[model samples]
Target: MKKFLVPLCLFLASMAYSQDDLLNSLDSTQVDGKTPVTAFKALQIVTLQSTKMAAKKEFYFVVSHRFGTVKDGFDSFFGLDNATTKLGGIYGVTDWLSVSLSRHTLNKMYETGLKYRLARQDDHFPVDIVGYSVADINSFLEKDQYPGLEFKHRLTYVQQLLISRKFTEKLSFELVPSFIHKNLYNPDIERDNQFSFGGGGRYKITKRLSVNLEYMHNFDKPDFYKNPLSVGLDIETGGHVFQLIFTNSQAMNESGYVTNAAGDWGKGDFFFGFNLYRVF
Candidate 1:
């Protein structure tokens, strides 16, 4: 309870000061482009999923690694000594649709999801819209720990709309409206069905390198968990996109990061992570 006191105070203070809602601030800003633009090269911009998808008949293998908190300094090898990894594969069913399955070391979690395009940023559409649905199962729990635990208690689901635009060749921005549901949860700490809004962007610095930044704010998330913030550099090589990231969220999947982010950016409590994707 003592440990949570500080975060609760901070959360209350933030809410009082945050008069402007994040999602409402982003009114439709049209870019000066006549042709359809390729907004980003990768499927995700740091923590926010981008509108990019694999080509039809193409498949992508993903490797994601998140280290422990860097606050422990050299004693923990700057977080390298304790790390969690996620390995997943994504396959394109069609040009506009894709499916994914992955497992993460954290919570012994398994995740599966799909991404489908609803609209493209072109002559007719002002923004690119993609729909994403995901499911998560926590395999780390045991019947011995909780005598009454059930299988449904370990499940979570998420749905999101990824809206993005390529304002210019060097710049692109995205907004994500997310809905998350947990089968079992503590009513006082957090709600069963959670809602969060996220947005991010990529700016091309040079030919093959870009800077990415994103932030997620949960309207219903508890104060013990801080909102997730991520910044990274995307290196676009010929075969893959390598993302070097620093984030306050240790969880790689949507459900974990959205609801259970456990790091505090104010104290340098963050994780060093990377997302690597190889297309075949």
Candidate 2:
């Protein structure tokens, strides 16, 4: 599956490149050489990716963590005993296109993804449209368990269309249509291909602080698992965007969280986490 990385990136990049002519024409939308920077300040509205992208030639490093359920007061050290971490880096291939790679402690997951902007919001456009796709490999699975398990079985793919609108400098909203495919799954438990729709928004509290909310609903997952609902606070400081999070989903990857959100909000099962990004 690693062999598909270059080809997949090239394919998506080409598609983004094809829209260059239209984007160039839209350059006139800028006023006094100033175009709106972004609907949101960070690369993510919460766990879900935002419409933001790294600038041309810029690179971003991100580290994220989600601790165990905070329901247990101090038994688990406030969920500190069972925390998962993800380290990732994204590079801008062009201002409108980017490539990313990340590794997570949970499931030993390795993720490779591409993000491209199809259109940027402006006076003529009502919203920003960005396409993001990711392929994750779970290296935690061992062949000893399932002799039939092949490398292909370890792969999971996700696709999302991020549509966002900035109604004001202090308010912005996004809608996401997401799809996930797992190469290995139990026929009795859930379908191999799953779909979901979600939306998120951010409200600025100050020049450097904002409150964000994100929720996702899976259409095909078992009824036992609840949809993920997350709330977070974003703080901007120089080159760093620091986010403090509270969510019902323990799995941070798109597919993992989408399909197997473990906690239930009704029971006060919540996980605390943070996502930090540094740009260079």
Candidate 3:
């Protein structure tokens, strides 16, 4: 019995030592240094959604405004007399997925969308890729105004593949291949389907300030509609971001803004606008 007790004690000591060694090894383990590179600092590069997304459990509120075109000059106070406003909210379900809902004053449009990150910029991937889907509904369209207007005619859909890369600490670029489908259109005046390519970039000038430019070109669009061009300055302060923008697009939603913009940049028809956003 004494011999057995001695061996049992020796075995217990060996087990305790091994357990301590295992814990020590775990405590000494180092974190991986190859963390993925973040592309854009903000959730949006300008009017276009950026490859970056809201972090998990985070929410963002955005208020956007675009006044009438400066073509009206002082009569409209450089387009301030008529303003299109949008209120939007986005919530992150996970680190790489987010959903958003927004309402715009123009056309009384309501939009809902989902954004998902497909590939992140890391040691293995050179660019960040994201997929975005949006549905826009125009509620102000009255059947009385246009006889035979169907309910499905009020809906438009947009799908895009967003690809971007941060080339330097201060420079980031993005490209979006977009498809827009509208159910209602004046057959001779508009097409049911359109394709567009959007490009944008941001140049950081200061720690909290950036210069952004965005443009979208639609293929086979009507001669009356011009492509949209926007230039803006982004200001970041704590949990708030303010964008001072100049744009040729008064419509806020993807389908309307991309396919139906009437303002021409060459004619000085741009409008002054701003977007105030906050994260909570």
Candidate 4:
């Protein structure tokens, strides 16, 4: 009986030690705390950038299309016959930093930009802050398009501060204060610098679907241009986010859409558009 009791005692002591070690390992992991809230689900809330970012080392491919104005009616297949498209790619350098390059069929514009997250929403923070800077070059612009146009005249720069709040699991909103600089324009008629403000929001209707709305108001809009207002539906599928949109803007890039929009929503000049985003 003494021999059996001694072996059992040793086995029980080993088991107790193993359990203590497991508890200590779990405690160490718990010290890292809970993960924070993810800001936006998609990279874009319509044409406006959202607070979402790609994970480190991840890549995203986006395709966007905008049809002509609805004012054309059936004559243009509700504007589908005059579609302008954009192709873009984005890469994450770090969880907080990303860069993208895109080409818009409208104006044959090419754009490159960087976005950085200054702050993220968490239990301690109420909002997500992001900075955006982009340069757009109108490669399609020619001397005939604008008399005496030089190569430098094709360049436009934009800067924006994006602030977003996730009020609840199903609601999110954002505001943008943006500045635009044009390298060359008709100085007699237009200013080289302009200011615009944008607002957007999203509401979830289902686990995989949501409604989105965005509008941009230019402070000193050109008489020929119109403010842009867009409404859309976001559908989330496996590794893809598809958006069906309608907007009073035909231009897709920040500079073009904000400053050169020609469609007037009051006149039923809105266009139908869609965007497809894929992650890899």
Best by lDDT: 2
lDDT digits (tens) for residues 82-145 of candidate 3: 9788999999999889999999999999999999999877767799899999999999999889
**lDDT of all the models against the reference?**
0.85, 0.85, 0.81, 0.81
Q: After superposition, how far is residue 155 of candidate 2 from its true place, in Å?
A: 0.4
lDDT of 1 by residue, 1-280 (tens): 3664485456335434434432222223344555455677788899678998776898887878899999999999999878898999999999799999999999999999999999888877789999999989999989998689998998999999999998987899999999999997888788889999988999999876899999999999877898999999997555357789999999999888877888999999999988877666
Expressed as tens digits, the lDDT of each residue in 166-252 for candidate 4 is 888789999999999999877766689999998799998987689999998998776888888889998765435678998888888
lDDT of 2 at 162: 98
Runs with alpha carbons beyond 4 Å of true place in candidate 3: 1-33
Per-candidate TM-score against the hidden true structure: 0.86, 0.88, 0.86, 0.85
lDDT value for model 2: 0.85
For candidate 2, list the clashing residue pairs, or say none.
none
Question: Which numbered prediction scores highest in TM-score against the true structure?
Answer: 2
Which regions of candidate 2 fall more than 4 Å away from where they truly are?
1-34
* Candidate 3 positional error at 29, Å: 18
Off by over 4 Å in 1: 1-35
